[model samples]
Target: MFPMQFALKRGMKAEMPDMDIARNLDIEKPRSRSNSHNEILTKDIAGALLDVIRDLKSTLEDSRKSLSHSAGAGCRCSTTGTTLSTLDEYSTSGPRSSDMMGIPPEIMSYVRTFGHEPATASDLMDWLTEFEDTMEILGLDGQNGTLDKRSVVARLALKGKARKVVLAKRAWLARQGQQLSWAEVQKSLRLAYRAHIPEHAMESRLCRFNPQEHSEEGTGLLIQRVLEIMNMGESHDNEYRLFYIISTLPDDIKDILLRRPCPTDEVELIGRVEDIELLKVSMAMNGREQGKGRKR
Candidate 1:
């Protein structure tokens, strides 16, 4: 017998190795291990599921923070096409977008400067053009050739019907492999809301603004009134436009103008009309200052 092996005392049972003892004991496997492959696979899947759940929770928290910090808050949309039909409602009937909390302060403030509410796409385009010009003037588009847009669209009166139209445009633009820019989006809005003026109606309105009716009015006031009406008609003909302005002049002024050799160019004629108005303005200002000096 080797020195490491000790002989047992009399009547002592032979002690088996731990391996043999475990095999004979019919003991359950260690809690940390499993003999069944299905159980191990199940555990692995459960662990992976837990990880995904944690990641999703974290993502949701970040989204909440972003919405709270930005204009995207409360700006929810459904995937269905319900939002498209109501596009004009928010810009017209709904509350002012400038009054909303999530709207970017700059965009919201700029939108409120519109002379007319953007009830149609054309009105919105005008607003966008003005907005872009004002932004350029203020140096918002940076030296890096990029602008700090900062959810500018979200600040627009774009909820409900407007949002739907935007979404549809987005898909169409993507299909054409076109990148969506702020100006482009506004262009789409314009297409959606463009108004077609009838030729007959425009001509009628232009004719109805009679210069003779305003003969009793101040020279400046009559010119201003005529121009405003012309704008409402959206007339494009320079010759036609100049003729309207000239026809509105008081008979005395008209006679004086008619005596002068008319300029060949339509632009020159418009300039001449503007010059007469300016002379009237100068005379009126001189009269005001003279009255003020008399009081002194």
Candidate 2:
């Protein structure tokens, strides 16, 4: 009976090794399946990333083409499409009046159209100044001849009512055998558009221009307005213009100006005012920053 029992126990021990092998196989099978699933997930992620990269590349290519097309067309694409379209109308090639006037596309591209309304007289003056500067830069100014380059540029620069007035003036001059000059065009436009205020009235207006009242417009604009008024009327003595501007400024600015010897000219005064404005802005920002630090 003892010998039989020993043989049975040995058989049971052999079966135990087979059961252990089966358990190990079952565990390894799941690990293998998990590794396969991970590989598939990794492949899907890589494919999706590749697709995103391809889409970005396509979009970038389209943007480049659009910008290239806009540049070749002589008008820049921008949020201000209407303005660009108006500029394009004058810039495009054709047997148009501007072309006949000898105005080049390069010049037209740089020149802005006149007679857009809700524009102040000061605005017109600013535009005229810019137009003259652009002409001078292009070597078109002071060309002595019947058809002056500056005159042609001025003609091409005008639009709407301003253009009509200038054309009438030009035609009249032509009938009298006199060619229109850039200077004449300037005078005509100023007379037609600039406010016809008397010299004394302009001086009064300048004196009344309070910088504090226009604080929202910034110091630069306030200075510009003062200078514009000074230019429009008969030239004042530098001392009087300086006194006028200094007296009308805010008390804080006036105090700062008084500490320095008076500026010799409007240009010098403007520089000083700008410096003071910058200093004040810096000090205000510093104060705010220090306040924040204290709260913290």
Candidate 3:
């Protein structure tokens, strides 16, 4: 008998105190009792043990039947063997699925689709921001997997001419025995589309930005737009960008900002201006509230 079978039989014999079963299984016999008593006890124990074994067999058969009925449900099984084999296969075999490369539906829906003709620097940058956000949300932003896999999934997020450009670039890399990466795809797309803009145009847009016209957009967005245009231009001078941004601000806020020491960078300048704008709004609200209280 197998070790498991032997152990199970021994356990039953030990629990029931059956002389016949003990002798059959080579277990040590218990002390002898009166003949009549031994006969009664043996019968009762044997009946109970048979009932237990019968119930166990019935349960296994029920399980086997259930598994057989569901065999077509992509679960591997074997009906030609013991219950153990079927159980083992049922527990272990099936298609292994993973979400490591899967993007959530919500994230996909939120990300903007690109591919329209005449992609501008601002449009590409905005789309790139959304793409980067999606990558970070999926935890694929770092050195998490092969560049090829990342590139493939990243391409799926794009459509139109943008997709075509990336696919062509990927093919070119393949010819050189190289795989395209997400970073390389981004660079390629930018160069093919946004890089050809005239520097004068970018500078012209920056210089003409009017914060007053875009007041409803809030100070932060206005500042961000200025910075984006400045980035597209050849000039890297923060002072020049700052000068243009300050010049565009409403005179009331600009005068207040001009009196303060100059900020170290555009970021510092943005923070200071936003704070000032918020303060101005708060004071205006307070003034109106005071006037209403006096009338009441």
Each model's RMSD to truth, in Å?
35.9, 33.7, 31.7
Q: Which residue runs does candidate 1 get wrong by more than 4 Å?
A: 1-89, 100-102, 113-116, 120-126, 130-296
Pairs clashing within candidate 3:
none
Span of ten consecutive residues with least summed lDDT in model 1: 4-13
Sequence-dependent TM-score of model 2: 0.22
lDDT of 3 at 172: 66
Q: Mind giving the per-residue lDDT tens digits that candidate 3 earns over 134-250?
A: 322222222323223323233333322354455466456556655355446545544434333335454346445555544434445545555565465544343344444544555
Please count the clashing residue pairs in each candidate, in the order shown: 4, 0, 0
- By summed lDDT, the worst window of 10 consecutive residues in model 3 runs over 95-104
Model 2 misplacement above 4 A: 1-149, 194-223, 226-296
lDDT of 2: 0.38
By lDDT: ranked, best first: 3, 2, 1
What lDDT score is found at residue 112 in candidate 2? 24
Model 1 C-alpha lDDT per residue in residues 172-236, reported as the tens digit of each score = 65567444454454443333332222343443453455544442344556556545554555344
